[model samples]
Each structure stands twice: as C-alpha cells, then as structure tokens.
Target chain A: MDKETQPPAASSHPRHHAVPPYLLAAMAACDGAWEAPESMREIISSQPTLDKADGPVSVTRTRIATRARQTMLLDQALLHERSTAHQKLTWLIEPTGRLNRIISDAQGVEITPGTLIRSEGQKPSADIDVNRAYDGLGHVYGFLADLFKRNSLDGSGLVLRGTVHYGEHYDNAFWDGTQMVMGDGDGEIFNSFTSSLSVIAHELGHGLLQYTTNLQYQGQSGALNESIADVFGALVEQFVAGDDAAHASWLIGKGLFTKAVTGVALRSMIEPGTAYNDSILGKDPQPATMAEYVKTTEDNGGVHLNSGIPNRAFALFAKALGGNAWETAGSLWFNVIATRTLPENADFATFAEQTLLQARRDHGAGSAVESALKQAWDTVGVVPRLKENDDE
Target chain B: MSESLRIRVVRSGGVAGISRRGILELPAQEPSGQQDPDWFTMAHQALNQLRSIQEPATAPAVRDAFTWSLNIDGEDHVVPDQLLVGPARTLAEHVITLRGSR
Candidate 1:
C-alpha cells in the first residue's frame, strides 16, 4: 500500500476474531507452546461426538473469526476497503441486502458490457447467460461477504459488472481488470461459459487476486494466480451447495462442456490431468505434483496447467480439516494474498510457507490447522523453504 | 500493397501449449517512388494505418489466453486479445488458420 493509505499497526482495530478470544489469550499466554494441553486435544480435534458429532462449532468458528480479523487487517492495503466486521465481539454479520449487479450483452461482439441489459435491482434479462451470470455473481459475492466479511471483489462494493454472449464461437471467460466477460462456446465442443458457477466465480476470483497481491501474471506466480482463482472458484461452488470440503466435488469448471466433448469439466482440483480426455480439446495437462510439473514457455509458463499442484494441495488441506472449506483453508489462502507476505513472483514453496505462517498465527503454534496445511503441502511435494530452514 | 505489406501475427498460448507466427510480409520497398502504382498506393495506405495506431495499455491477462502481436515492416503493435478488430482481426484469423492452433 502507498504510504498515504497504510493503516497503523495495532491490535486495536477490533471487530471480530475467527480464532476465539479465549484461545488467542491462551496462545498468547503459552507463547512457545506448539500443541494444546492434553485436556484440550479433543476440542482441537474438532469432532463433537468422539464418533463424529457437531458439538461446539465455535472452535472452528473462532479460527475462522481470527482469520477474518486478519483478513480485514490485511485488506486495508487494496482498493477503498471498509471494515466489513460486525460490532466488537460478535460473529460476522451477513451482507444480505447489499448487492450491486450489472449485467450486459455483447451482442456477439467484443464491445465491453455491450448494452446495459440489467442493472442493480433490475429484473433478470430474458437471456439465460445474463441471468446465470447475475446469479453467479451473487453467489460469489455472498460467499466472500458472508464468510470472510469481504464486501465485494474489491472489499468495497465494486459493481459486479458482466457482459454475456461476448463474440461468436468464443469459448472462455475473463476479468478484464475491472469487469467480467463471458463467452458462448462454439456449441460443438463446449456450451456457454456461464453454465458453470465455478467458471463465473473463477473469473471474479481474478478480480479478488488483482486487488490484493496483484501476483505477476507469468511463470510460477501466474500459476499461483490461476490456482488461487480455481481454488476460490471451487469454494464458491462448494459454499453454495452447502457442502463440506469432503462432500465438495473439487472440480473447477464442471458442466462447461457439452456431452459430445467426452469431458467432465475444464479443470479438477482433486485430480489434476484427469478433468478431461477428449479427441478435440486434447487432454487436461495439469500436474498434481512438482515431480510432473510442466516446464514451458507457453500459457504464461503453464499457469493453467501447473496450477493443479497447488489446487490439489488446497483441496487436500480443506478435506483434512473436514468442514466448510471457506472457514479455515480459505482464510489461510486468502491471508497469503492479502498479507502480501508472498512475493509477486512467489513460487509454490513461498506460497506454502506463507500459508503455514498464517496457520500458526490464526491457529495456535503447532495447531492442527498448521499440521493439516503442512501435510497438504507435503502430500503435493511442495516442501516449504521456511520449514527446511527451521529444521536446519 | 499486396506484395509489400507483410501482415504478421504471432499467436502465443491457448488451450494447447502452442506458439506460431504467420508473416504476410509485403515488400520492404523499392522506394525511389518507382513501383507498381496500385501496389505502391496500397503499401502507403498500409503504412499510414500502421503509423496511425499507438498501442494501448496492456489488457488484463487471461488463463490460456492467446496474445496476438502484429508486426508490420519493422514496427510492432501488440493487440489486446479482447480488442482485436478491423484489419487486425482479419489478419489474426488468417494467421490462426495458417497455424491451425485456433
């Protein structure tokens, strides 16, 4: 952030804490303690019945709350951010009534937001893509606002502007820095890009990333950018379905293609390289581990392909925690971006380390959140440099 | 113009990891003001068109994005993917077909 905009560093900007107040106090008191006291282990484990019950969710809710506070702290760096927190000691309040939707038509051309077909508080257009786009925007915005207290794509109500039917036979969707553009596929291979909630949220996720770290759109960093989009995109889908991480499909662009294409989705977070296998679109070329990472000078250094590694790591992490993926896992990843702890050109190792640090901060030292994140990165073969350095 | 205006498009990155360049290079010029009159007029027109454009700021980068760099003579202009239009669009499509990476 520019010097003019930086907030003074303090613990005084109180709103809400995802990590419970008592836990933060205990963590502060314990200081160097890695694991919780033996008596608290079951609570930290987070299963209610000892046979899988939904007891006090405040433990999970508190961790989410702590990260929520961290998120607000970091978000001051980007855009005109207002704290989306509720009163001092309350859980996050919902952004139920504030939505600014603007849907437009490109008329099969490239003109941006071609004609304003639907504005905020207006009725849905007759076009399916327009309605789908509008609903998708609401879902994602609701996810961030409700879960993380993020106001919008910019952490302030940046109008969720979108244009549908952009260019004939066009087969992609993108955020052009300010607004979104969706394409109607060529009908033979793929359907309209707006068919998938993940696809729409994925494009909007780019807007979120842009406002934060603005990770350079090339090489490994670009892959992280793509992976971040896919990660949050899947979260949006999972959140709307009310699915826990275990129940979530972990597919990035499911339902985007036609049946003739012989593919399930555009990308898969859980199983990279296996999302599609078609005679026309070739194969899904993502690598799930660094061992198979593609070294290329194309796709901005295989940003779309190699993103699968981190994508899988995020999926594994959220599933291991076994709850709403948006709560803990989402907070850690969002912290990495919002904190600017990772460099603009950060590699997978760098990203993994920042997440680890966030896990330690929001959760206690050596907490299960930290353990899950560590295992997730390790399973994907992304051993963080900081971990190795600490081990040394 | 037909012989001298080489409309080249270098397409980089799409679904497939493919990079291809197509050059419709027109004559560099036999510029003593002595050439086929029609061709000379076309070349001047193309040159004027090229000189008229000042490349705009870069557009937001997209995943599996196809970036088109149009090089005319020695002057090069990078066309934002969403904004490719007019003669540039016509030329880019020709290049995409030529490379078969469309």
Candidate 2:
C-alpha cells in the first residue's frame, strides 16, 4: 500500500540481516505467493521499491533462488544463535558504543515504561514529552559515553528506558530502580519535567550512582548521592552548552518553572538557597556550607537540603579549576566513585577524603587539583570526621 | 461540640527536592449521626492502617520519589511515596490539593 499504512519497521533489530533496500523490495514484488518468514516479510514490506513495477520474469527466477538460499540462515533458531553470538562479542568489546533508549507514555498514571511510544533510532514522537524524554536520554547518554567512557547508566549498555506523563499533576522525575519516570508538572509552579535537560540528567544520575558507589540514601551519604546527581546534571547541561566552569550558570532544573513562579530553578550550585524565593513555595532552604547544615528527620534527614553543602563545594572546586568542569573535577569525582571502596554510609567528610585520595592518585600528591579539592571541602567546612562506629 | 480530625502531610524529595506542607482539619463524628466527609472518613481509616504497619527504619531505596510525613491528630507516621497506598494515598492527596502549602 502506502508508506503511512505500512507497519513501523523494526530496522534496528540486530537479527535483521543487512539487505539492500531496493533489492529486498524487488525480490518481494517478484515472489507473488512465495511465503517468507514473519520478520522477513516485515523487512521486505518496509522497502520503498515494493510500490514500484514488478521486476522482469528472468529477475523473478533469480530472486526465488536467492531468497531460498537466504531462508536457510533465516530460521528462527539459527537467527537467535547468530544474534546471541553478536551480543556477547559486542558486550565484551564495546558496551557503551550504542544507544538503546525506550521512551513510553504513562497517560498521567504512576506506571513505568507505560506504553512504548518511541525507541532508539526512531523518528521523534508526536508528543513533546515523549520526544523530550527521548532526546534528553540521548543527551545524557552521549555526555557519559563521550566524557567519562561510561556504558549507559549501568556502564554495560543497559537500555535507557523512560516514561512520560506520569501521574496527575506530577511535578517531578525519578529513577524507580530500572527506568526513568518524567512528570507533566502541576504547571502552576513548574512546567513539564522533560523541559529541562539538567533535570533529565539528574534522574539518570541516580541510576549511575546506584550502579557505582551506591551511597546509602540517608543523612550525609544520601545528601552526597543527591549532590552528585546535581553535579552530573549541571555538568551534562554545561557540556551540552559548551559552557566552561566559569561560564556555566550552575543551576539545576533551570527553565523548569512557569512565569507565575518566582524562581529560576530547583537549586543553585554556585549559590545555594537562592534558587527560589516564592511566597507559595517558600524560599529555597539549601545551605552553602557545613555550618548551615540542616539537621532534620524529614526528607531522609534532609538529603535534598544538606546536599547544597556538597553541591556548593563541587561548584567551587569546578570554578577553581576554571575550565571544563567535566574534565578535571568531574573526572576526579567519577574516579572516586568508580573505585567502589567508599562506604555506603560515607559521610561528607569521608567522601571528601576519598575525592582527595583520588585526586592525589590522578594528579600528583601536591598537584593543584588536590589543593583545589581540599580548598573546596574546606570552604564548605567539611573536615574529615570519624563516624561514630569508626571511633570505636 | 463537633469532633474534628486534623491531617498534616509534609511531602518531600522528588527531583526538585522541595518540601511542601499541607495541613487540614475536617469535621468528624457528627453528633447528629450525619456521615463524615470523605476526607475525614478516609483519614480515620488511613490512620488506623498506617498505625498497623511497622514504620520503615531506612530511607526508601527509590531515588527522587517523594517521602511523606503524615501526622494525624498528634501521631506521626512517615511513609515513602512508593509504599503509600489505599486510603492513606487518597487522604494525603486530598489534603495536599486542599491546602497547597508553601
């Protein structure tokens, strides 16, 4: 029939053998009643030449023989075996080289990967939220793979899955263990969750942290988890914008607010507690240093609030480097995480020490990187303090 | 005197990491035997259910999900967003929608 009426092609399926588009169409036209495998039929119909004139009688005879030969290798079991072999080899050699993104729609419900709306290599969806989620995942994946040599969120080519339009008036995005969930926001205070790339990267950051250091999600460790997420969020935004440390705005979730809200973003890395001062939303309560650390039982011991301390510290460190934050400071922090020796319940000081250690390992013991890291932690008032259990 | 049930829901976490406080008081147990409002009835049932479950000692493993600190009357129960369900979820939603706190 027509291209619009044709079933969407599964062109990216690894098992689909490479056949020239025009040839596949010509073969399909000449086949008449020749039955092909289900997957092969899908591939043949997707070719543009099917709508054109059928090939000559001589060409049809050749096409039937060629198709019969290829059909032997196209058996379900044989195809599966070949694909598995390819997968194993790809996993070992270059896991992070390809993108495997899947974006879905939740239809304003709290379900994940709700309805498959988009997949990797597909054209943009009609919905902006779906397209944004798709593009945002690509951006974050590219940032990690290009800068950090990471293989997706799990560092092993884990499929980047996401759901958009999650929950009614949902004003947040999150990583629910396996996939990313984006919300449409209440629209009064915040706009669509996918509107900001930093926000998307921040959620993906949680996934990265889970696969890496897995810092406990409470108190200081939890705050560090949030801070690192914010750091990566800011870094991804800066990397995409080509903004160096000094030139970056360092705002997380920037442009997420509607005009009615009296705020710029969710949090400010450079100047904590100043992201918003809305009468309805209240002032942002982030602390720029340890002295202002908020001790509370709510929000998992104020993980979000206290994270500002480390967030500010990172921003300071990156600014001190005065260049690509992702290059030096970001690399050092990621290196510390990749080591996987940091305690799950590591306090800020413990994390700071790990970073210092990593910095020394990467840049010499007395290098400027080490000094800048030390100064950043010092500026944030994070001194190495033993945990209560450690004191024992 | 008309009996009133109070609900204080503090929703925190999420990508924004903002904490929102929504406090509400609704008439309950009408002396005239009139039925209580849906919120009051739901709150009563939710409080009982919430009290029955043991409070989680550790933070929720899910990242960026909201944590809800719910106080009914003077009693306190903190429930992570993932665990909040049934009547408690509805009651909390109602309170937040009604108050829209700062």
Best by DockQ: 2
True lDDT of residue A255, candidate 2: 90
lDDT of 2 at A117: 91
lDDT of each: 0.69, 0.77
A13-33 per-residue lDDT for model 2 (tens digits): 243345443344344334342
State the lDDT of candidate 1 residue by residue for A24-135, as single tens digits. 3233222121222233344434532111223464344323333333544443322223333523332212222367999989989866869888887778778899999999
Give residue A201's error in model 2 in angstroms: 0.4
lDDT of 1 at A101: 90
DockQ by candidate, in order:
0.28, 0.58
Lowest-lDDT window of 10 residues in candidate 1 chain A?
Answer: A28-37
TM-score of each: 0.72, 0.78
Candidate 1 TM-score versus the reference: 0.72
Instruction: Provide i-RMS per model in Å.
Output: 3.7, 1.2
